[model samples]
Target: MQTVRVELGERSYDIVIDTGILSGIGERIKGFNFSKVAVISNPTVFNIYGDVVINSIKNAGFETLNVIIPDGEEYKNFNQTYQILTELLKNKLDRKSCLIALGGGVIGDITGFVASIYMRGIDFIQVPTTLLSQVDSSVGGKTGVNHELGKNMIGTFYQPRLVWIDIDTLKTLPKREILCGIAEIIKYGVIWDEELFEFLMHHRESILNLDPLPLTHIIRRSCEIKAEVVSKDEREAGLRAILNYGHTIGHAIETETGYSRFLHGEAIAIGMNREAWLSEIMGFLNRKDALKIKAVIDSYGLPSELPEDLNADKLISHMKLDKKVEAGEMKFILPEKIGKVKIQKGIDIENVRKALN
Candidate 1:
């Protein structure tokens, strides 16, 4: 097994990655003091892995309850959060009880948000079952539901006690899901590790085939990079903001499309490409490097441009609602080059308009 430690002082935890290790999760989390555990998941995921996880937790001597919520980005809202919160209350889960996020990013976000608000705060574990969640959302403590106007506008920096990633879960995912995960992995490369970017460019076939060697390497590297950033900033107060590399415009697309048209990482892939173009136009990145970014993204079969039907005006309007906005001025994490990015604030709306168009 490979491990990445998220060093958050008192709240620090380990992210465990391996193949076919799902059966051992019980012994791994047995050290926590909680007597009761709630596994929160969507129907699709629970149907596949719920019994194994719950049985493992039960064997470890905890009272376990499974709650299944609807699966989709649109279901991540006040309604589902309230429903989970009510279920926890009805089942009498208290401060000493832990919540387990047992699905993908949406499940992880909602479960973490519920744990944060439940009894003023409770321990939560992330058993992310999707590639997108395993490499990205499962590592960071950012948790929240979406609002009609914005993505992740309603969330908290609540940390998890553990992130158990089992690579076998990838086998069940669709090719598009794997591509989505690659988008975030590519984000890590572009924002922090040039070597990682080159690795992806060189080993595309092996990574796409889910070859254990390269697949494990990219996942571990992505987790390590995220762990380092989160440990330093912990709350997006400074250095952590760079992790939002493509998220500024990505979240806007999700909001404008009502979160149904594209998966989160799919939207991010498009955002990264468009933002790379913006970087070039604004003089931060050279055309050759910008094209390189686009080239890699394109090679993955991910979308690299806004749909012609999307209104540029509406997309810009949604961006204004992003959390990065300070005093109503928009900020962007623009790539200066691969392996580095800077937070650019007070950029003219006209420049953003040109990029969107």
Candidate 2:
């Protein structure tokens, strides 16, 4: 097992990555002092791995409660959040109680948000089942449910007490979901590590085939890169926004489609392509580099182009509403090379339109 630490001083936590670690999670987390435990997951995941986790905790001599929510990004909302809070209330969970997020990103987000707000902040652990969650959403403290107005609009930055990643859990993941996770893995390579990019290109087949070694390395390195970034800029005041390289336009696409048309990583895949084109037009990245990025994304079976029905004007409008925007101007993180990036402000709308075209 390899451990990476997100150093937030009082909020610091370790992210443990290994295979078959789920069987020992109860003893692993027993070191933390808490009165009670509640695990939040979706039915799909509960049927698969929930029993083992709950039993493990129970064996460790802790009272445990399970709260299962509906699956999917669309269901990450107030109604579900309310349901979780109601469960916590009925169980009389207090600030000392810890919430365990035991599924993919949606479960982690909702569970973390509940822990953050319930009784003015309790503790929580993250057991990310999907690759997207393992590499991106699960590690970061950013937790929230979708609002009627937007994705993750109602949220908070509540760090987890610990994060447990078992790569074996991904073997049960569907191919499309694996592709969705690959998008975020690709994002880490595009924004920070050239070696990681080369490693991905070389191991594409192994990763796609779900070979254990390659997948483990991919998850570990992705978490390392993400941990390095989050350690420096926990609140996203400056450096962390670079992690949002493909997210600006991606979030817009998600909002426009009402969060049903594409997976988070898929939308970000398209967003990276659009941003790469804009980077070329603005003289930051070369055309050849842009094509290479698109090719890598395409090789993973991810979409490299926007849908024909999506409107450029509407996308731009949605971008304006993104939380990253400041003082009426949209901010974008654009690549200068495979391992480097720059955030540009007041990007020309005409250039954005041309990229969308």
Candidate 3:
């Protein structure tokens, strides 16, 4: 077992990673003095590893209940959040009770949001089952549901008490889901770690085949990079904005497509590619390096270009409403080179148009 710590003083927590770690979670988290615990998951996930997690928690002597929400990005909204909140209330859960986010990014996001707002605030644990959640969403403590107008437009900076990652859960994911995760993993390499990028480029087959050694290495490295960044800029005040490198255009794609079209990582993958082109056009990144970024994305079987049908005008319109915008000027996190990026503000609309086209 390996652990990565997110240092936020009192809010600091450890992310525990390993295969078959799920069975030990209750024992690991039992030290907390919570009065009650609620496990939040979707039907699809609950059907898989639900019993193991619940049994582990129960064996640890904590009173717990399972709250299953509907699956899918479209269900992550006020309606589902309200449902979870209502369940917590119905069960008489107090402030000391905890919430366990027990599925992928959507489950983790909603559970954390519910914990943040439930009776003002409550503790929450992230047991992210999917690769995307395990490496990125589950570690960052950025939680919330999507709004129709924009993705992640409504959310909180609430951190989880612990991030419990069981790589074993990844075996159950579909091929598309695995690709979604690789997209985020690639983002970490592009924006922060050159060695990681090279590792990914060299070991594409091993990683894609889900070979345990390389898979665990990338997940650990991605979490480590994310943990370091989040610790420095917990509220995305500065350095943390770099984490949104692909998200500006990505979120716009998600919002414009109504969140039903591309998964978060898929949209972000496209965003990263387009933004790389924009970076080259603006003279920050050379065409060679920009194409190199695309190559890594392509090698992983993730989308590197926007769908031809997605309107450039509408994508821009949605981007205008993104949370990253400052003073009506759209801010973009553009790659200066692999392993580094910069926050470019007030970019010319024509430049964005050229990249989109």
Q: What is candidate 3's local distance difference test score?
A: 0.91
Worst 10 residues of 1 by lDDT: 146-155
TM-score of 2: 0.97
Candidate 3 runs further than 4 Å off: none
Top TM-score prediction, candidate number = 2
Alpha-carbon TM-score of each model against the true structure: 0.96, 0.97, 0.96
Model 2 C-alpha lDDT per residue in residues 1-357, reported as the tens digit of each score = 989888888888899999999978899978787799998999999999999999999999899999999998778999999999999999999889999999999999999999999999999999999989999899979999988776689999999999999989998999899998898888888899988888888899999988888888888898898888999998898899999988888988988998778988899999998898999999999998899899999999899899999999999999998888899999999999998999899998999999899
- Ranked by TM-score, the better of candidates 1 and 3 is 3
Q: Which RMSD does model 1 reach against the true structure?
A: 1.5
- Error at 325, model 1, angstroms: 1.4
Residue 345 accuracy (lDDT) in model 3: 94
Residue pairs clashing, model 3? none
Higher-lDDT candidate of 1 and 3: 3
Instruction: Give the Cα lDDT of each candidate.
Output: 0.91, 0.91, 0.91
